[model samples]
Each structure stands twice: as structure tokens, then as C-alpha cells.
Target: MNARLPERQASRALLIGSSRFSHEGLHDLPATVNNVQALADALTDPAMGGLDPSGCRVLTDPATPKQVGDAIDAVVNEALDTLVLYYAGHGVLSRHGELFLAVEITDPDPYRVHYSGVPMTWLRSALAESPADNRILILDCCFSGHAVEAMSGTASAVGGKLDIRGTYTLASAPAHETAVAPVGARFTAFTGELVKTLREGIPGCGPLLTLGDIYPALTRALVASALPRPQRLNTDLGDHVAMTRNPAYRPPSRSASKPRVVSQPHRSPTGPHRRASDEQDPKVAAEFHSAMLDVYRKAKKEAGYNAAYFLQMVQEVGGLEAARRLIRAGSVSSGFTALWEKGRLDLSVEAVVLQDRFAGLFTDEELDIARDRLAEYGYSSAQTS
Candidate 1:
């Protein structure tokens, strides 16, 4: 069945990660930090999940169960169309075999976990009570599949069977299997694939990615990687709820129209004016560059601002140096005018140069030049859409 993307303004997401644990028995999952940040970036990306930046909240190393509970409660109260809850880190079992999410202060002792960690029941209850039509829960932790049982009313630890009518639960591992977090990996095995799937998208999927579309992809990826298989539970057509735009979707090609020919002045080949075709026909070159820029802009708009490979290059070499390299490589040229003319100020080099994270990379004069160029194009920070 065809699935529809959620309304960005009416959706809310809560991402919780516990990276640092106080008890020595539980090793610190440094990868959890990257997991939360990358997931947040993917979800809020205009070309992907398209959630409002304000609507997605990240709570890392939460100090207490109350803190996590309160954050979940807040988003549950505000979300109207879709509510997404994601948690990564350690999952401990209570003495009664119930699942409890580890926090910074959570002890490894199963008896003490009930008081120190956030119980899965809290999330189950939240999902049961949420007013949103579509509720999604993603757990990346050890024995996360226990959540599936809890949601299905088979787990005795949850006290009584709970109704999960409009929810979809995706877990990283089976009840007995431990989720993998390779040493020095940027993210846990499960979440790394999840983020990659969200960013790169499934090639054969429809324009919008739904829970059902994502699950098989995730399973195939995990199986290919030799990782533990993930599990899920869906009810009331929860699997059809669209989560993000598919980055890999391609429209069918149509016949191309004839190119518009512009008249050019005759040039002397023997004089100093002799040069390349672009130099001879500046208008034609500008048009070519404009077309190339359009392709780049379309890619950025569909894949996401952070999903570009150039952004990674910028991150590795610094933004200004990356720009210099691109210029030297002749992969890019002065195309601000082209971008401005096309109402794609978001794709302007100035937008990247002036980003707060790239501060101190460009000189004040260079920044001023970028700002002036954008201003000339009637670009404003508030005009992003």
C-alpha cells in the first residue's frame, strides 16, 4: 500500500542515549553519542525525515529516569500526527526479566536497575496513552527484542497485558542476543545501518519510506553484515506510517527538449582574445554552470544538507580549505549568481562558509563578502524553506 509522509510541523521525536555509565560493569558506549547526533541530524534534515529542528529533542547521558520520562512525556503531549522515540546504549534486565534502559547512574545490578534505570513499561504506557495516530519506538540496545514481548502483553515483568494499538516497535536484537558495538566504531552496529539507510535510502522503494519499507532493508543489511537480526511489532497499520523521504527514488526519464541557442559574437583565433570555449562564450558557460548547480541543488534538496559527500570533505579538511581544494580542482566555480537567480540561496557557498560550526575558518572580509553577496540575492536566514 502507498504510504504518506508525516506532517513535519505536527510530528515530534525524542532521542535518548546513555553513553557514560557510572558502574564499572557497564562499559561506556562512546558510539552512542554519535548515534544520537547523527540520527537527530538525519531526522531534522529537510530532505529526509523533515522533522522540525525544534520538534526533535536529544537527551544524552540522562541523569535520572525522571529526566528521560519527562522528556518523553513532553513530546507525547505535543505530537499530534506522529511520535518517534529512539533509545540507544545499554539495556539491562530486571530480576523479574523486565527490560530497563540504562542511564548514566544506572547500576549493573539487576535488583538495583529497577530504581536506577528507566523501565520499558514507562515507554509502553506512554505509547498506549499517546494521542498521536502513529507512534514509533526504536531501541538499539542489548536484548531489545524483549520490548516486543512487553508490547505484545507476553512479558510477565510488565505486570499486565498492555494495548499497543497504534504503535510500531523496532528492536536491535533478540531477547538473549547482545547488540554489537565494535571498538572505535562511530556508531553501534544497528544504528550505523539505520542512519545509513535513512541517509542513503533504499533504491527500489517508493518516494516515501515507511516503517514497513525500512524494516526489510534493515534486516538485509544486518544479515549481510553478520550482525544479530532485529525484530519488530506493528499494530493498526503502524507499518504503513511514512517516516522519511526516500533519497534513492528517481523519476522516470522523459524525452529532452531542444536546447535554446543564443547568438554569440565572432572572435579572432590569432589575437590575444583566443581562449577556451567558456571564455569565448561566457553566456553559454554560465548556462552550463547553472545546469550543474541545479543538479547539485536538487541532490541536496532530496538527500539532505548533511548527506552530501562534500560536507564530509569539509568536515575532514575544514570548510575554507575544502572550498579552496574544490576551486583548485575546478569542480566548482563562482556560481553564487546562478544559485541566487534560481532561488536556491540554501545551496550558496556562503551558507556553508557562514555556518556557526565553521566559524574562524574564513577571514572577516571573506565572510562579509559572502554576507553581501547573499544580501544582494535577497537571501535571509529566516527565508529557509
Candidate 2:
């Protein structure tokens, strides 16, 4: 272990999330990807965690052990003052009571566990031996508690009595429990609340919040959700370290600050009257809204994404009336296709305008689905700038 210096420490983070498993029995964890993204965003948000973007390394759906090992080595070698390593995926406890982090290609067979996943033993050793004074591990997976147990099991096995003197480990669930993602939510339960705490700030945490300060609230949320309580294990950290700088977050003012005086434009009474068809009934409009949302939901499910860009594009063309007609005609697909052919949906423009709005929301498969949708409407992601 390296000696702590008198000066301020540089910081680096490595975030890993594995969603797809090649093994037939192991189901994919779609929420892991979202958790990784949410954490990344929180860490990089200037008013929040404020870590330099270049110092953060992210790996998603990595199948090979080399990919994971190399990433871990790269970040650990940096020897920064602060190092945060986060993993969200399937975690298995072996027959020997060892913990293993599953990768995309990890076979579900119990006998093949050694070859399929990374051992928590190796990770613990790496972190313990790292020069960084502040080593933080955040695990969001089933059996995450096993990793912590393994870390403390045999200190000598992980580099001479396991020098975890300044390390902090946070696990989403207990050893025998499973970490759950809330229904219809984009992020896993643990991370969703964590991000909210980071972004919105916690009362009495002051202007700056530390991982230690946020732990209690996080524990409360998990318990309220009926989940296994999250655990935070620390080894001889003398003082709490600030994880993020919370801006002066406040509820928006309920009443408008100032009312603007507007001059009404004069209209010609003899001009053409508004079309009765354009003035859709409130009930019909509500149904149209619901139907439009259904179409978007279907598209998202098929595409495996939750980007708002799809809704924006649909709204750009025909508004609610087009959606009403499609639902009424019992032909959402073909109607959408017809709208595509009419050049009402500009794929390229929408992609550019909503790119940031939808960042980290679309997976490769979802983008492909969106591409297919565009093709049916005579457009392509490649063709769009």
C-alpha cells in the first residue's frame, strides 16, 4: 500500500454493468445498464459528484474476464487519492462460499463458475493493495454481501492481512438476498434512491454530502421497499469524505414570480371559422393520448429503450388527431408508416435534437429497433447525420 500524501488527492472511478448473459438459465438484467448510466451521470454532474469525465471508465455487458481484469488494473494503477469501483450484475455464491461476479458470457452451470466469473477475492486483493487512500466499492447485485464476507474472510489471502484500513464497501443486499429493481422504473431501487439523494441532497447533510451521511436514508428507503437492507462496511476511515457537492436544491416556488401583461392580437371576425374536427372532444383527446402512449410503449418494448425522442417525434407530426385516427382505424402500425412516408417525421433532425435528451437511454438493440422503425417509415440511422 502507498503512503498518504499531504496534498489533495486525485480521483478516478470504474463502473461496470453486465446485463446480458449467454447462459440460457441466467436471465438478462436490463436495469443494470440504467444503474451504471445513472451513477455515471451523478458522478459527472458538476453541481453533484463533479468527477472529471476522463478519469471515469465504464464497461457495459463485458463477457470476457480479460475485459474486466484490464479495466480494474487500469483504474487501480492510476494511484489516485480516491478510487470508486461500482459493479451491477448477477453475483453468485459458489459451493465453497466464495463470491463471483457474473459476466455476459458467464455460464449458469455451477461447476463452470470459476471460468465464467471474476472472483471477489481477486478484486478485494487489488483494492487492498492499491495506492489510493480512499478505496470505495459499490456493489449492486444479488449475493453482494458475499463479496464483503470474502473480503474479510482471509486477510492474508488478499495481500498480507488485507490492508483495507481506508476502504469503504457498500452492498445493495445481504448475502442470501436478491437486489430488486422497482417495477416500471428505469433504474434499480438502490441506485434510483441513491441518485435522488445525490441530485436533490439530503437534509442535515449540509451543502456537501458524504457516502457515510447518505447511508442511513438509503437504508430506510430499501427497508420501506421491503428489500434487504443495504450494508456499508468501512475499515478505519478517520473522517467522512465528501462524495458530492449538493447545490442549493429547493422546491420550485409554488406561485408564479411575476405575471406578464400580454396584448391580445386582433383577429378578423370574417375569417374562416375553426374546423369542428380540429376541436377534438376532451374524452377523444384523452383516448388519443392513451393510444399514442401505447404505441410508444410498444415501440420501446420492441426496441428495448425508454428514450423520450420517440414521443417527441410522434408529437411533431399530426399531434393528437393523427393518433386518434390511427387508434380509431385500428391501424397504428400502418398509420405510422404512412406518416413516415409523408416526410413528417424527420429522423435525422430528431436524432440530433434529442440525442442528449436520450443519452444513455438507448441500448444497441433499442437503437436497432428505432432504426427498423425508421426504415418502415423510409429512413435510416446511417442516412441521418
Candidate 3:
């Protein structure tokens, strides 16, 4: 075992979320993709007290395991202490009791396997190669047991013991159960609810927000949202599930400079924004915003993504009334929960304008989703807030 560990817990994270990938309808539902992305963002967030935000890397399938492995490779080599891995999407188990990632691959032979998912065993080995003191893994897929069972059951990554102290693992649901999520509302589904817990509701839970407290809260939320009742279970692979070993985590001192923390992401020019202010030109920012926009626009058609964007952008250009005509035009799309409260769920010219206004002044936290909505409307993500 590679017993030598980091002086403190420096971490590197890898996030993977598979979507409507398998031909056999693996990611057949919208929630499947949305949940994966949400979970990825949650896990990679440095604010979660998991890792250095800058060190997180995300990989998607169709993208090879080699490519995925390669990204994690860089972080591991950097000597980060904790390695946090999160996966969201579909998983498949074979009669032979093997677990696979079930990418956008299909088995043409029906009776014979044509494509094989990424084996979790392969991933555990990769983590073993890292010099980090601990590893925290989270998987949000169906049939996730064998892979984790394989990783945790085998001894020898942390210290001399295979089941090392301080190594933590959390799985969305237990093995063999078909986890359920909304057919299309991925973002607000079970996974989304969990993020909400961490983001908006944790403090409300009172006192210390331990993983023991947090994990089950999220699990209960997930099972509660399951339609027609879901087959669900949460697992604690090893004994040491140290909720979060936050090096700098502490209650803010009641001092003159102590600022009340708000749940919103918009907290002014904090990290990246401030950093970008120094070197990035407007054009570079535009490019970054635009690229992500394209992907969002493509997806907006199904959700109310585009309408909101169109309304907002129109206000940014012409005026509020001009945006209304578009909302009143024709048949509305589905999926998104009606969020605005301009009297009705329908995007009134006024709410559209307000939406646009909010987008203009979006808190950094709200910015990404706002950008995605803009993308639905074919707007650039880099629109200066």
C-alpha cells in the first residue's frame, strides 16, 4: 500500500455524468442527465469542503475511459491528498456480477455483449496509484454496488489496511435497485433536491451539518421524490465516513468584518471574476460564455430554457413589451417548473423583463444557470453581469 500521505488534505476531484447514452435507453429520462450534471457541480464545488475548487475536473462518456483516466491522472500526480470522484447516470450489471458505465454504447448481438461499460475496479486501481491520504467516492447510478464493493472490499490504498481509516464513500442508492428520477426534470429531481439541502437547507437542519446528518437528509429527499415508489438504499462502505475534513472550516468569528453569508451564488467579484478582471479581455470572456451557450440553447427547446432567454434578451435590446409578443406566440414547451411569479406560470412580458434584469445582475452563483437559459435563447454565456 502507498502509505505515505499528504501533510494535510489537499484534494483533486473527478466528476462524470452520463446522459441519454445507451441505445437500450440508459439515460432515457431527462432527470438522468440533469441529476448527473447537478451532482458533478455539487461534488466539484470547493465550497462543499471537499477539495480545492481549482483542482476539480469533469469528464463525460463517448469520451473514453482513457480520456477520463488521463484527466484524473494529472491531479493524482500533483499529489493532492483526497481524491473525490462522483458519477451520475445509468449503470448496468451483468449476470456475471460485473458493473459497467453503460456509455452511449450498444450491444448489437443482443445475446452477446457488444459494448462494455467502464469497470469500477479499473477506477479504484487508478485511485490507488495516487499518494493522497484519503478518497471519497460518490456514485449516483443504478447497479452501483459491485463496483464499490470491489473497491472498498479489497484492502490496500490508504495505509497497510485495505479498509483504511478516513476514506469515505457515499452512493446515491444501494445495489440492484432501479433508482428513479423525473422523466425530464433532472435539475430539480432527487439529486437537485440534495444540492438544495447542502446549499439552502443545511443550516436550517440546525447545529452541525455532519455527513451523517447530510447524507441521510439527501437520501430521504431522494426517496421522497421517487414516483411510484423507488427502490432505494444508501451505503456506508467503510467505517470512517468523516463527513468533511475541512482544513479552513470554522464558524466565522463575530467580528467587525464578519459578513453574513447568503445562499445565493452572487456574492460579488470573488475568485474567478476577480482573477479574470486582471488579464481577460471582454472578447475572451464572450467566447467562453458563447460556447457554453450553444450547448444550453440546444437543450432549451425541451425545457422553458429558450423562452426565458428570448424574453430576457429582448428586454436587454428593445424593451419588455417587445419580449411579451414572443411568450404569447404559441404552444409552450414542458419540463421546467414554473419559477417566476408574475401572477401566472406563463412568462408575461413583465416577468420576462424581470428575468432579463435578474440575468443582467445575476449573482455569480445564479450566473451559470442563467447563462444556460441564455444559451437556450442562443445568448452568450459571457454576457458581463
Candidate 4:
């Protein structure tokens, strides 16, 4: 039966979301927590699909780090078939690649922080200790990096093979950007789409939707629609991950009715996306530039990266085609940056050209249009940025 296959053991989901918190109160944490509760309910409903709630334990929202840590500690030892941790609140990341998913966090403070958010290192250790051989983490907060960032580089196959455990982290954005919450959406854009893709039974959903796939989907969609795009950070040492293209996966149908959770809202997770296509429409491409410029502005206002850096990008880089592909890759894809870091070190005209304002920062390749345009300025290489 589809209800029970491959694995019939217990499973657990730890979820958290925070929003609209007062200087001392939480804002929108309830919405994401509520959605997770619904997801938990659906997972428990034998009539709809799979296992019973008895097979799983859930930790929704804990006001303190110790509370969260303690709750997760209990779940880790439960020996479930699949262990999932979903956090849907505001997240903050440090320059050192650390991440935090807030619970009762009222204000942003790194040390002596309010409302403890479980650290990625700690969470990963918990996963390492979890009795489950398969562990999946669906992080809906911004800058939810750490565990995933640890797993980013190409690795060699040592010993007989590299098979330890299955760990998947779906972070909303890079550790450096703000996560977007759509105007009327119950939760943030990343959480909404994730629920849709996972529930839609879309072919590209689930374990197939790797960090690479999800990172781009959120960022690109955010950039296209004028919402803030989250940076995608990931980690997987041995096994391959399928990003939104897994054949065995299926999304859940649109809820015929809204389901209530313990003490929160009854909003649906899946909804419509609002980005224009760069590949298909030239007009969209032009608009995207303006939209990205806005993104550049917000990045400066919110994060404080040098304005000239982004301004140089918008003014110097000419075409957006590469950006489309770049954001789609999900990772930082800092293509224009690659020239300085990897290809050109001397800051040659090529290096400077790579950093051109109009040049695509999202990708490395130069589209035909970009190439011809650059040629008009004396550079002939149409190669990706």
C-alpha cells in the first residue's frame, strides 16, 4: 500500500516559524507552525495517504533554545524511519556561516540572543545521532545555512563507498539576505512554494528537489516577482540530491477544505507564483533588470553590502539572460565574481568587464545578445560570466 512502503517505522517532524514579533512579541511564527501542523495532520490521516501520527512525534514551537534543543533531543532518540525538522520563522546568519531559526525571538541579537534558535551544528549533530538512517530537514527561515554549507563542495569516494545517512536541508535563501513574506500569503514565499511543490505531487517535488533546485526556485521567483529572494545554502557529502525533478515524488492535491491546527490559522500552503519568464519574453527581461535593481537596493538597505558593487553590476552588465540561468542554479552562482576569484586575478579589462554593471551576476555564461553587445565595446568573448 502507498500508505506504508520502503519504511514503516516511526517518523518525526520538528517545525517552527516566526513573524511580526513585537519588540518583545512574536509576529508571524504562528502561520508557519500552523501549516506544519496541517502537514503533520495530513501525514497522520490514513484515509488521505500514509502513516498514523502515532508513528511520529512533532515539536512545533519552543520558546527557548534549551526547550527546542530538549524537544529535538527527545525526537532524535525515538528511532523514526524519517526525521524532519521544519522551521518557518525569521532566521539570521553570521558572516562565519552560522544559522539561527528563531522561536520566541523578539529582536535580532547574535549573542545573549532572545529566544534561542537551534544552531545548525547542533541540529546536524542531532541528525547524526538520530536513530533514523534517513533524515530530512525542511528549513523555511532566511539564512538557514550551516549544516547545508558544510556539504557544498565536490567530494571523492573513499573506502568502499560514501553512505552514512541521508540529510536534506531546504533553506529559503543565502545566509546573507532577507527572506520574503508575500503581501497576503500566510507564510513566507519559500514556505508557500515548498508546501505547493511537495503537496502538488509535482514530479519535481520532494527528495528530488535538491538544494540546487530549491535555491534557484525561491531566489529567481522572488527576484522576478519583486519579492525578496532568499539565498540557498546546502550540504550533502556523498549521495546525489534531485532538486524538484524527482520522478517518484508526487505533490498533494489542493485542499478541498482548510484544516485547523492546535491554536493557529487554517491557511493552505500551496498558492500561485508571480515571476515573469526571462527566456521567453524580452519585455520581462527588461523589467527583471529594474526588479533586480530594486533587489540590489534592498540588499544595500537591509544587508549593507557596498552599493557601488551592485550599482556597478546594474550599470555595467548589459543582458539578463545569464541571470536567469544563474539564479536557476540556486547556489550563489556569483558568476561575475568568479572571474576575479577563479579566472582573472589581475583585474584586467576582462576582469573589470566581468564585473560590468549590466553583466549577469547570477550566471557565468554570456548569451549571444550579451556577446554581440560586448563585442561592440571591443570584447569578443561571449563566454559565460
Candidate 5:
């Protein structure tokens, strides 16, 4: 059976990576930081996972179990279609042979782990309780394979015997083996391959990538690199859920023998004006332009400007009307802050509406209002211009 990508708005992902450790026995994994960031980028890429940036959350160096649990619970509550929980850090075994995910203050003592670490059983229970149709748990730490055992009802860990349905658990290594994190590497061994697969994609896979398609490729790559083989446990076709669009997929070309027909340009009317390529509604044009700007900024690794919500105001009212609303609102919007954070001062509303291509979209008074808004935020028109 064919599988498709999850509904972007209905799916949520929480990525947790503990990169530092205060314990003497546990070594710090600096690569885990890069692992979370790179994975977040891959998942939020429109050409790949197509998830909204707001839907994916990254937590680094969590201080306690409650912090991680709270974040997971939030995502579980928000996600209706798919929930992805990813963790990268140290995995230590307790006295009862149970797995415990190491946090910033985690100690090596088995008895102390109850207070310092997050038990694998906690994750299992969370997944079992989640209302999402598909639950994906990715663990990149030593003894992570124990999670598979716990979910399968074979592990003797406390609270590990829960029946988790519609879940897929992917572990970096065997229950006894240590996951690799080569020194000076950008990402952990297992996650590096995962990110590569999400970015470059499998050559022959169809248009969408599923867990079933990714597992064998991961196995082959890890074996070639002489790394510990990954393990997985899937229940109720969970493996068939599509994770992302295949980057390497190419649609078949049209037949060369088909005859070509040329047609006159179609003109759309806007009030008393008619244009061949312009949108009939100025508000719609503004929204489209704003969304396209976000796509461009994202490709360049800049922070998103929250174009969807911001542009909705323009779509509901015309550009000039939206400008009046913004002036009356008397506060800078999040989109402007996002632009400021990315050092994209040039994309501000004052600069955008002032561009030659958008000259007539807003009146001089509206342009002055935009400039005044920027000035209120301590930016000059000359700087934005």
C-alpha cells in the first residue's frame, strides 16, 4: 500500500538533545546540539517534511525530567495526526536493567538516576497515552534499543509494560551496544545518516519517504560505515506513515509527440484596472508576495517572518486598509521582530511598500505610517531603504 505525508498543520515534532553533563563518568556530547538543529531544519523544510516551523520545537540541555515531560505532553496534545519525539544524549542502565536518558545534572549512580534522569518508561507511557494517530519515537543514545523491548512488553523496567499502539520506535543501537559519536563530528553517527536521508533522499524511492523505505537504507549505510546496526519496532502499520517528500523524486516528462497550442494572454480585472499577470485582489497579491518572501528567506537560512498570519490581515483587508490597522494597533508585529533578528532590515514593511514594483499598492500616507512604525522601533527609513 502507498503512504502519503502527514498533514503539516496536524503534526507536531519535539526534539530534545542533552549535550552537557556534570557527572564525572558521563562524557559531554557536543554533537547532539548540531543533531537537534540540523534535524529541525530537515523536518521544517517545505520541500521535505513540509511541517510548519512553529510545529517543530527544539529543547537543548534539559535540566530535569519534568521539563522534558511537559514539552512532550504539549506536543502530544497539539498533534492529532502525527507526533514525533526525538532524543539524543547519554542512555544509562539502572540497577533493574532499565534505560534512563541522561539530563544535564544526571549522575552515574544507578540509585540516583531516579531523580537525575528521565526513565524510558516515562516516554513509553506518554506515547501510549497520546491521542495522535501515529507516534514516532527516535532515540539516539546507548541502550536505546531497550525502548523497543519496553514497548514490545518484554522489558522488566518499572512502568514499561504498557500497550502502545500505532507507534514506531527507532533506536540508534542495540540494547547492549553504545551509539557512536565520533570526536569533532558535526552530528552523531546515527542522526547524521538520518539527516542525510531526509535532505538528499533515497534515489529510487517514490515521491514520499516512509519508515519502511528508510530503515533498510539506514541499515546498509551503517554497515558500510562499520557502525552499530539500528533497531526498530513498529505496530499497526506505523512504519507505513510517510515522513517527508523524497527530494530525489522526479515526475515523468510529458510525451514529445503532443501538439502545442498557443493562446492569447488572459487578463484579470481589478476595479477599473486590468492586468495580465497581477492578482485581481490587492490583498491576495500582498499575501502571496509575503509568503514568497518567507520562502526566499528560509532558503537563505534566515528566520521566518511569520508571513502566514501577518499576511492574513492584508488578505482580509486591502493593503492600504491593513496599513491603517497596523498604524492604529500601535505595536510592532512579530514579523518585524523576526526580520530584525535575522538582520533583514531591508524587508520591513516601509521598505517593501516603497519598492518600485509595489509603488501604487500603498498611498504616501500609508508609506509614512510604515516609516513611523519603523521609527517607533528605532529604525530609520534610510537604514531600511
Candidate 6:
């Protein structure tokens, strides 16, 4: 039998959904409860996140201010290594720009929000104070973007802003936009698409699904539904930090007996001589890089904004055989670059940190060329240093 890989860090989730409100003007949302249950189920699926059912809490109809605070404290005080907080309901914004998660008895009155709603600041404080190594916040409600604005930038204590370290925040809409819950649907637009992405999993993204892989798909799904576009605030973790395992991972077939080898025809003496080193021809590498840029531009324009689907689109743009040739030739920089742009930044300072990894896959000449091109986009050695 093959040895299994060790499990990921222990993680817990708290899902809250509010449907009813004290004010009659705010109609109850039928999809909110469904969102909580579906997400909870996915979190507990062995083929998915594999979280313990007892560690995942689902609070429907939204708990009061005190209950929400207590719940956060209890979860964060545990010995878990990671904590995820998800809220699906009506997100309210005060005149001064503070955000709140509306509870079952929350009053719609703009002036009385303090008395009825749970302030996002409270949750932020809890997360900032938590001992967990990683924290994730997913908000699927109107004006969820305010949460991102509330938590942006490096760790600091002033203004009650949460320390941005070790945290990833996914907001369903812009600060002023309304996150829609389609009537009769099983989940909210933001979460319904999220669930689908989680189930299908992303190709070329390995056995685990990180928030980095999920963001592009979720944004495209919401945009296609004509719902508010999702926003994300991410921290630079050196490598991909996974939130869950792909539901579709399967072990490779094993063989007990010795494997057989097949022999190929020997090259004729007159045939072209092949180099022993893995380094690729400079001209061929340059051509491959140029072709990749063209394909990336076309893919960006025609493949829509969903990066998850672009993997197949890329295969279609360049035939499978050509891709295989590039890989065999050790010209993997092009493909690595294409994959990185699928979800990560195009030309931000963050790209500088990833330059070494992407360039390492290239030959010396190709690496020089890549550095030159990246420098044109402000990714310079000085910046990274």
C-alpha cells in the first residue's frame, strides 16, 4: 500500500445566516439558510474539506450581537490552527461607514442599527486577537465589500482595524452594492457559484483548493449572473495556502509486480545530434514565450474572466502535442507564467516575489529575457530585494 500524505492543519468554520428581520420592510430571504447548510455540508465532506462536523457550526436566523461575539470568542480560543467565518444575510452600513451583519431581530431603521445589529468591528477584533495561524472571512451579503475596506493594509492597532496578517477576506459585492439571492435558488449568487467551484475543483491547481484558486471562478460566476462583482483582500503567504481538499482527488493505480520497459528504435548515425543538457535553444525559448503572450492575450479576451476554464482554453489554443514538446524541451516558463496570471496580479509589486520561481523554470537566456520583460512592468530586482 502507498503511504498517505499527512493531513493539513486542523480548521474550523462558523457559518451564520439571517433570514428574518424585525422590520416588515425587510423580507425574509429563503436562500440564506440553504447557503449555510450547503457550505456546512461541503466543509464536512471527507472528499472536500474533511472538517469535523462538530467543529463546524451553523447558526441560522442570525444570532444576536452578544451571541455572535461569544461564538467568535469560543471558536478562536480553541486549539485549532485555522478558523473560517462566513456570513450570509443583509449587511448594513452606517452613515459613518461602519458595517454590520443584520440579525433576525435587526431593525431596518438607519438610526437604531447599533441596538439591533452585530458590528463587523467586533468580529475583526476577535480574528485579530485569535491565536490561529490562518483566518478566513467570507461575507455573502449586501455591501460586503465594506469588510475588505475595513481590513485592508498591514497589521496595525489604530482605528480598530484588524491586523491583516494571516487573513484572507472574500466579499460578495462592492461597499454600496447589493449581493443578490435569486428567488427560488438553493443558494445565494456568491455562494451558489462558490459551491459549484468547490465541487468541480480547479485543474492544474493540485489536490487542494486555495482561496487564490477560487476567487477568479467566483467573480466570473457572479458577473455572469449579473450580480455584484465579488472583491477579495489577500495577504502574501509565500506559497498557496489551501482552505480545502479537492473533492475529485483519486490515488494513482498501483502495481505489485515489476514494471516492464519498452525499447525504441535507435537513432541513425546521420540523424541530427541531440544535446545532453536540459537547457533549451535560446531561439526556440524566445519563440515559445512570444507565442504564449499572444495566446494569453487572446485567452484573456475570449475565455471570459473565469480562469478555471482557461486551462482547457489554453490547450485548445496550442495543440496538446505542442505543449508537450515545450515541456519536454524544458521551456516551462511560458506555461508557468500563464497559470500565474490566471488568478494572481498582472503587474503589481507582489509579482516581484514570484519572479524567481517562474524564472527558475527557464533556461539562462530565457530567464534574462523574462527579467527584462518583467522589469518593463515594474517587477525589478531592486523592488524584490
Best by TM-score: 6
Residue 41 of model 4 has an lDDT of 59
Encode model 5's per-residue lDDT on 1-385: one tens digit a residue: 3477878999899999999999898999999999999999988988686578899999999988888889888898898888899999999888888899999888868777888899888888888888889999999999889988988888866553566788989999999999999999999999999999988987645677788667766876896899998988777667668788888875534642132222333422211121223335666566646644544356245554445554566667755455445443323443454465456756655556544455345444445556665664456776632
| Selected candidate, larger lDDT, 5 vs 6 | 5
Model 1 misplacement above 4 A: 253-385
In angstroms, the error of model 6 at 96 is: 0.6
Candidate 1, residues 29-126, lDDT tens digits: the string is: 99999999999998889868568999999999998889999999999989898999999999999888889999988986987888899999999999
lDDT of 3 by residue, 119-169 (tens): 666566666666766666666666665454656564222123243334555
Please give the CA lDDT of all the candidate structures: 0.74, 0.62, 0.45, 0.47, 0.75, 0.62
Q: Return whichever of 1 and 3 wins on TM-score.
A: 1
Superior by TM-score: candidate 1 or candidate 4: 1
Reference-based TM-score, model 4? 0.50
Worst 10 residues of 1 by lDDT: 327-336
lDDT score for candidate 5 against the true structure: 0.75
lDDT of 1: 0.74
Q: Which numbered prediction scores highest in lDDT against the true structure?
A: 5
lDDT of 6 by residue, 1-385 (tens): 1111113346677898888776785778889999999888877787665567777888888547777777777777762477788999999867667788998778766678878888877777777887766778899999888888777732232275456587778899998899888888888888988888877875433466666557755665677667788887765441135656765544333531122221322643212221212224455444444544455565457543333232453455532223333332211132333344453334221232224323322333333333444453334544432
> Clashes in model 2: which pairs?
none
lDDT of 2 by residue, 1-385 (tens): 1122112237788899998998887788888898888888888776565577777788999988778999999989785688888998888766666678999888756677888788887788878889887888889988888766656654222334667767878889987888886666788888888888877776533445656556655776677778788866656541255677755434323342222222332422211221223133566445444555665665455544343543664576633543322222211132233234234444222232113223122223323334444554455554543
lDDT of 5 at 248: 80
Off by over 4 Å in 4: 1-6, 19-28, 45-51, 94-97, 105-107, 150-165, 203-385
